[model samples]
Target chain A: MKILLLAAPCLLALAVPLYNSDSPRLFGFPFFYWALIGLVPVSALFIYAVFKMDGGK
Target chain B: MIAHLNWTATLVFVAFFALVTGLGFIAGRWRAGDLDDLAEWGLGGRRFGAWVSWFLIGGDLYTAYTVIAVPAVVYAVGAYGMFAIPYTILIYPLLYLTFPRLWAVTRAKGYITAADYVDGRYGNRWLALAVALTGILATMPYIALQLVGMEKVISALGFEGGPWASHLPLTIAFIILAIYTYQSGLRAPAMIAFVKDIMIYIFVIAAVIVVPLKLGGYGAVFDAAGAALAKKAALSGKPAGLTLLPAQIMPFITLAIGSAMALFMYPHSMTGILAANSGTAIRKNAYMLPAYSLVLGFIAIMGYMALAAGIEVKNPQDVVPQLFLKMFPSWFAGFAFAGIAIGALVPAAVMSIGAANTFTRNVWKPFVDPGIGSKEEADLAKLMSLIVKVGALIVILVMPTTFALDLQLLGGVWMIQVFPAVVFGLFTRWFSGWALLAGWAIGMVVGTGLAAGPLAWTPVHAVFGLGFSAYNGLIAFVLNVAVAGALSALLPNTAPDATRAADYEDEALA
Candidate 1:
């Protein structure tokens, strides 16, 4: 269960064909660039949640 | 043709360098411990809290070369270079899952290097020797390559002379680094890591915000970068785009996964991971270390920013330095250059210590001296660390730079072969030691042969009638696992397990 949560970011991010477009610019940045940059924090959150679930204080 | 040294910039660079030198030397006393103990000297006594581990590992992994090279790649090849982004993003969860288990086991069993753990688990000295030798082979060249990053900044600061004399500043800086590291051990880099990371954070964040604003914001920068890439593509008749070309998608993802797998396999990364105070510290760092990735994302973007700024240099590695020189004031450029040079110093220290630790614990003690005392072990590791650094320095000064770069290229492919032995053994003792050793041997030859022979040192190659190309390391790793699994099913387990199943559990959970 914890492994699934942690693998979320790796799966979603490495699927380059899905989100490789320059369209849907975020604040003057392309979707491809901004999305990957934004995923950095999201990936951290997923790992943090797994940590908390594992009885981490 | 060397440019004139800017006095203001040189002074700022010197000031920062001197400050870090003092920190490096004083670090010996910072976390007071018996320097005679190999654990203390090699792993900082495993006393680093979550935050300190974050800085130390962050500074260790995202090296000065990474700071320079990531942007250089983006500058040279457009969005293809952003493979490092996904690679960094993918690495954290992998760390979150695997490394805590490694920390727990190593703590319980007093295993200093991954090879030591392999020896303990498999009870096979030959297999452990393979792991250790592969580590040293991969890392020694890496230490030399760190100097390439420092040399870039040193020359950029306009320190010029004859060939030997021109490298004098870099040599002097490394000598100071070697001395403090010898005196202090892991703490030297760990302490200096604090300053190195802060300087990097300041400069990268400053560049991210200030560079875009200087170039009239992200929109103009991307447009200009796209235009520039398109112009280059037209001239070269090769596909380049603001986004990934269809043909590039496979290599990009494969490179990302291959690199993430290889990153922690290196002994230096293991050194930083093992130095944490507890499994929870390593776990906490999983979420925290991505902050550096965010910094790296911005750093990668600077390559595009360099294009927008019309900065031209014969070498792409100079893009970041050139960007700073053109965009920022002279003094701040100096500060940025110092940040990069010190960045190089931290990893070189850690890499040498890591390889040296592998030699002392895995090779020398087990093979050379069965009853070596802790003090002698620590002393030997210290001496070995000095030798590794001097050897790397000589490699840089005497040999052509491409030799080190080529070896480093093979280094990744070679290092990943150790993965199945170390990481696989973490979860299951089902695989036989001999099987794992055979797998490693086959993987090394195949990976190196393909990389050096047919692939021509390119990272990705077309595999087995698959139209798409994949990273050679990943391809080799798959073959490694297949061979190990097939042989494990056939061969009886010969070596008894040294660690119990519970040994892999964190203390809080256990």
Candidate 2:
């Protein structure tokens, strides 16, 4: 379960087919641009979840 | 040789530099610990809580070169330079999984360097020494790149003089850094990192918002950058624009993943991890550190803004600094330049301390004096820190800045080779010391040759005739793991393992 959560971000970010484009702009950022920048928060959330599950406190 | 020397910027830079120097000196007493011990001096007493660790590691990782160079590349190329984005983002997950275990084991063993952990895990002094040597070799060039970052900011501020005049400020800055780091090892960088991080956040956030609005808006900035790349592509007969080409996808993914793997392998990063107060602190910082990457994403756009502003610099690395000079008022520009200059200092201090600790603990203690006391070890580390700083200064002064930058790239290629030994060894001792050593040797030789030869220096292209070039480090890493796995199964264990599996698992509770 932990490994699956950890691997999700890497898979989504690096898969190439999912985000390699200039269309589908969000807030004027191309899909490629916004997707890469957007992943920062998403990856952080996954890491935070893993930390919480690990009893990080 | 001063082109557009703005007194306001120079004064602001000087004032902030003076303030940080004062903080550097006073850092000796901050958090007051046993100054004579390596743990106390070299690792900041190994007691950094989440907040301090956050700022320290943030300041250490998002360096002056990163701030200057990332935008520079983005401005010069296109989406390719944003490789730093995914690399920084992915690093947290990897760290989340690895650093807590590393911190637990190192803290339990009282090991100050990764090589110390290697020695304990495998009971082989030679394998440990290999890790130590790789750490020092990789770190020196990284330290040189920080000096190069300082030099670029200095030159951009119109201080390009006869070699002596231009380098004088950098020399003085490094000398002050060497002294304070000598006096108070890791504490100096940790304390000054607060001032540096604040300055960076203020200026970088300001640049992202102010620079785009000055040149109309984000749409205009992208259009301008796209037009510039299209023009260049026509002349060079290569595809270029605001988007990545189909061929670039593989290289981009491999570069990001390869670099993420290599980031924590560097000795300075490991130093930051080990300095945290607890395993929980290490884990918490992993989640928090990505905030800097968000800031970096904003900073990356400043490169696109530079294009829209049409700022011209001979060296692409100078584009962001030149962009600041063009876009902002004199006083604010000075603040930006000062931010870059101070950004260089924090990482240099941390890196020198990391390299010095690797030398003192791994090399001197084991080889020079097997029974070296804590006080003497601290003294040796202090001296080595000064030597490493001076050595980097000499390299920066004598060599072209591009050479240092290339060496910095090569440092990553060299460092990733150690991942099999250090990161892999943390999980399982399935590989013997001899196999790990052999893998490391082959990886270093082949990785250096591939990265430094055609890929870096020569006109010839294509890495390993793969038709599409990828990050040389990743290629070498795959080979390193393959050789180690094969050799581990084929060969007998030459040295009996001193550390048991329970030692690694027990770190979870540490």
Candidate 3:
């Protein structure tokens, strides 16, 4: 969990469409396309942090 | 270069201010007590239900700054500004999971700020005091940002006075905010949000429908913008930052997550949560706030429209106003500016009250003299609120910070450090109060250092070199959580024996 948290930043980086200038398209959508698809997973991780945190009161 | 300053619109703004001030004085009696009860006066009797909470929380979440800045970022930054759209939407659902719990527990214990909850929950005076100090410090610039928003409208409308009077308009407007908020506490801003939200919805709906039509259409606007931005990027070797992609995924997500954490912990935000009638209302509001987030998505896109229209804004802050003026008539533009101007009023008032509440409870009562009566508490709260507004005014004029339009991107990094003690204590009793304090100190130091350090080229605003940055504040926040956890392991928990952290859970659950 500890190491995972530091790498947490790396996961957030995938939020941008990961594409080289050479790549034409993914599924007929541009780079922004793939990033939007990952939105839910990224959000889930953030929510998980909240749940995992000790105090909610 | 500037929108016409229609006296008629100016009169409308004045009338709105006068009515709000009148309402402010009258509000002293709306949720009246003996004039001594701090909670009753400072927080609107902590009895706010759906309607008032709707307005207060809405005003708390959205601001005049949102009216101008989001679109301005969209105008200036392009695709990167889209981050706020997702962040705003994400914030609502995020709050849905956490806010109700905080609300239920706060109301059950009659806590006012997050600090009050921190003190009561962990039975740790220092930890609570840390929360209080963080809130007061964080709120000063937030209030200053609202003043900056008002300045955007005043400047866009060309309300310049003498040259020596560069910021007179903002000074005058904030002075009004100071008086009204001091008099009515939460009620002033709570009422003003009604007008502000209505105007925002009107401006946003009009911008979505009319601006697109006037600019030839959303598709044309985006196509032109993407091409223009691409052309600009090709001409300039450096990264255009917003328009062009450059490994933005982690920064965007960190910005969102860190912002969401800071959002719930803010003093004024916590004030809205605590004032709710029930945990359910807070949750419901949390869900509904996304509705506003949907509007923010449109606001961010407006920046693109401005870019496509070749709309040249004099000041970066004028981007939204100039965009609206180009698309709308003078009369409709009046309402638009009204929306933006009054938008500053609501949160400005709430921030002042949140700061006042902290000073009265945390600094004044405990340190100065515990014997201070409830009446004195209300009185002192009112007084300190004045000082907060004045401090904000100084920041506006003296500091390099911009007006209500000011973007303290570093604010999120510094403010989020308070999370461990405020929100973390909400769920765990195993951590000692001293541990919370240690975590807070380390977090503040590390976050401040990270903000001041150079990690990458992403300085908070490119000016501070790579040393100061926005997203890295999350780095500090994570460290804060770690220090707290590690310290908790090292030190045994020491909350008073009478106060088991779970002892209040049943009441909250009820």
lDDT of 3 by residue, B212-318 (tens): 78777765676677766676568875344333354544466567667777887778888876778766566556545556666676677677778888887666668
Q: Which 10-residue span in candidate 3 chain B carries the lowest summed lDDT?
A: B455-464
Error of 3 at B351 (Å): 0.4
Task: Please give each candidate's TM-score.
Answer: 0.98, 0.96, 0.85
Which candidate number would show the highest DockQ if scored against the true structure? 1
Question: All models: lDDT?
Answer: 0.92, 0.85, 0.69
Ranking by lDDT: 1, 2, 3
**Across residues B346-460, which tens digit of lDDT does each residue of candidate 2 receive?**
9999999999999999998898899988788899899999999999998988987778777778788888888888888878888988889888888888778776573454211
Q: Interface RMSD in Å per candidate, to 1 decimal?
A: 0.7, 1.6, 7.3
Model 2: how far residue B490 lies from native, Å:
1.6
- Of candidate 2 chain B, the 10-residue stretch with the lowest lDDT total is B454-463
Q: Model 1: residues >4 Å from true position, as ranges?
A: B1-3, B453-455
Best by TM-score: 1
Instruction: Give model 3's share of reference contacts.
Output: 0.03
Model 1 iRMS: 0.7
Tell me the docking grade of candidate 2.
medium
In candidate 3, which residue ranges exceed 4 Å CA deviation?
A: A1-57, B1-4, B31-34, B163-166, B241-246, B402-407, B453-470, B497-510
